[model samples]
Target: MEEKQMDLVSLLLRPELPNVQKELPTARYRVKRLSELLDTDVVFTLKGLPYGKVQKLRESMSDDVSVQILLQGCVEPNLKDPVLKEHYGGATPAETVKAMLLPGEIEDLSRAVERLCGYRKLTIEEVKNA
Candidate 1:
C-alpha cells in the first residue's frame, strides 16, 4: 500500500473548492491548529481583531492601548473588503491568515502565512509605541 502526501490547500479544500465557504471563526481555528503543528506563527492584520477598546481605555490602559496599537499597525497593506468598504481585517494573527484563504485560493496559504507573520512583527512595533 502507498501513502499519499497532500498539500495544505488541498487538505483545507478537500470537501469543497469552487463553492467553498467557511465560517470565519472555524477557519481561524483550522489555521491555528495547522500553524502549531507546522511550528509556524499565523499572523493577522489588526482590523480583523474585534473592536471595543475605547471603553476600557481608562480602566486598562495597557491592555486596551496594546490592542488598539496592534490593530492599527497590523492591518493588511493592500487587501480590502468590498462589503465593508474597508480593508479586509481580522481580530488576531490566526484570523488574518484564515481570511486570506478563500476556498479556491488555498494554494496561496503558505505565502499568506508568511505575510501574516511579517505583519505580526510590524504590529509588535506599534505595541511598543502605544
Candidate 2:
C-alpha cells in the first residue's frame, strides 16, 4: 500500500504536467458578420480567462458580463488599442465591443470564453474516477 501511494505521487509530479503559471490557452474566432460589414476577413484571437477572474465576474452579476469577458479575453486586434478605440468614436474596449457586435454575437463570444475557461459541467462520478 505504501509503495502504491508513492507511485501515485510520482505520477502526479511528472515534469510533463502543464504549468499553470505558463501562458494561457488561446483560440481564434472569425467574425463572419464583421467580415461582411468590413468587406474583409476579421479574426479575433482570444485567451482563456483565469478562474479567479471568471469567479469574480460571475459574482458581480453585472448586466454587461459578456462585454467584460470580451474586453479581458480578446487578445487579437487589441480591443483596447488607442487607434481602434478612436476609430470607434473614442470608445472604451467594452463600448467598442458593444458597438461592434450585436447582442447575440456578444453572447456567442462570451460562451466561447466560458469554454476556454473550463466552464463545462462534469459529473461527480467522473471526478471520482479521475
Off by over 4 Å in 2: 1-6, 121-130
Clashing pairs in 1: 43-93, 44-93, 48-89, 48-90, 48-91, 49-90, 49-91
Model 1 backbone overlap count: 7
lDDT of 2 by residue, 1-130 (tens): 9998999999999998776437677898988899999999889888888778888987885688988887878888788888777777745777877777889988878787777777663423533535
How much lDDT does candidate 1 score?
0.38
Candidate 2 Cα deviation (angstroms), residue 41: 1.9
Per-residue alpha-carbon lDDT of model 1 for 29-124, expressed as tens digits? Answer: 134654676798654432222133323442565432433333333444323344332333665543443464553333233333333333233544
Worst 10 residues of 1 by lDDT: 20-29
lDDT scores in order: 0.38, 0.80
